[model samples]
Target: MAPLIAVAHGSRDPRSARVVTAAVAAIRARRPDLDVRVCFLDLNAPSVDQVIDAVATEGHSTAVVVPLLLGSAFHARVDLPGVLAAARARHPQLAIVQSNVLGHDHRLVDAVRDRIVAIGVAADDTRTGVVLAAVGSSDLRANDRTRALAAVLAGDTRWAETTVCFVTSTEPNVGQAISLLRSRGVERIVIAPWFLAPGRLTDRLEAAALQAAPDVVFSETIGAHPLVADVALDRYDTAVVAAARTRLSA
Candidate 1:
């Protein structure tokens, strides 16, 4: 079987890396027979190229690179592909296939929903407003996709309204979102992160939310959630199957 390499956008925070490790461990635990490894794109060790080189050195003919990103931004679109393409050139014997990002699947809604409820906010509380937060991107479309998640999360319950805010971008921000919910006569506010792991970025967002509304509740990120691991493995399996089909056609 080909080794599955889970790639995450590395963060300076140690908690983020630990969560990535635990997430892949969940994947390995679910499919113990398969070889699962974790790597980072930047700001961390065992980078994507390092893992790719290791796979080639280990004599694996084929490998799958599953990006653990929630958005199809520059890192997912340009960064990882560039690394994989360069790796392919360096090792012609290795056939590398990149999997889809870990987003757009409905299962993630369940994962975020779990985070929301864990913060002591009732799912059906109409007076409670939700702020679905994410790391902003330069790609406008990617940010739009993140904004859509707010609606999906709102559908899960009757929470007053769910609005999306960014940690590092212009226009809509955490403070604005919190104020919007408050304007709607929502006294109870919950800020749910659309993040895979807790990092400095998440901390920044929480700080902004606190500044806007001191009583706001910020839930933990979707770190190492079993459903997140499930999504990564599903993407890996999907890519493997697609690669096999392409070979069959060839």
Candidate 2:
């Protein structure tokens, strides 16, 4: 089996790395025989380059790099590619196939729904307004994708209203979203973080929401959910098949 390298966007908060570790562990639990490793793109140990070098030293000629990201923002488009290019150059014998970022997948939406339910919101609760919160990006398309996911989540969960908000680099910040919900006469509102792990941004979003509405409910980051593990494995399998096809074509 090809080694599965799960790369995450690191954070200064220690809990962030721990959450990622748990997520990788979930993947390992599902595929116990598979070799799984966790690395970070920044602010954490075992960087992507280090992980790639270790896999190469372990004598694996091919490996799969799975990006633990929700959207194709700056990290996915620019940082991960540059890191992979450097890794390929360093380990010439290793064939590292990069997998797609975990974009607006239904499983992810399910994970969000699960988080909402964990916070005591019923699936068919029409009185509670839901706010999908994310670490915003300069890429308009990335923001658009988040909005689309918010719509899907609202429809699937049958919430009364769903709105998109950002923690940075975008409008309708968490505070603004909560205000909008409150203005619409929503007495109970839940902010579902569109993040894989708990970090500074999640904390910031929660703080902002509390300031806006002291009674607002904030859900946990979608960490180590079974559905997320399934998505990680799916990306790994898809990358492996794609790599084999490329090899045969060559």
How many clashing residue pairs appear in each of the predictions shown? Answer: 0, 0
Candidate 2 has its poorest 10 consecutive residues by lDDT at 151-160
By lDDT, the best candidate is: 2
TM-score of 2: 0.97
Residue 123 displacement in candidate 2 (angstroms): 1.5
Instruction: Estimate the TM-score for candidate 1.
Output: 0.96
Name the 10 consecutive residues with the lowest summed lDDT in model 1: 103-112
Give per-residue CA lDDT, model 2, range 156-199, as digits (tens): 66677889899995998988888888889877899999999988
lDDT of 2 at 22: 97
lDDT for each residue of candidate 1 in 1-250, tens digit (9 for 90 to 100): 9999999999999999999899889999999999999999999889999999999999999999999998887888898999999999999999999999997677887788888888787778888888888888887887877788888888769888888899996549999988787788987988888889999989899888888888998888888889988899899999999999999999
Q: For residue 167, what is the lDDT in candidate 2? A: 94
As for model 1, its CA RMSD to the true structure in angstroms is: 1.2
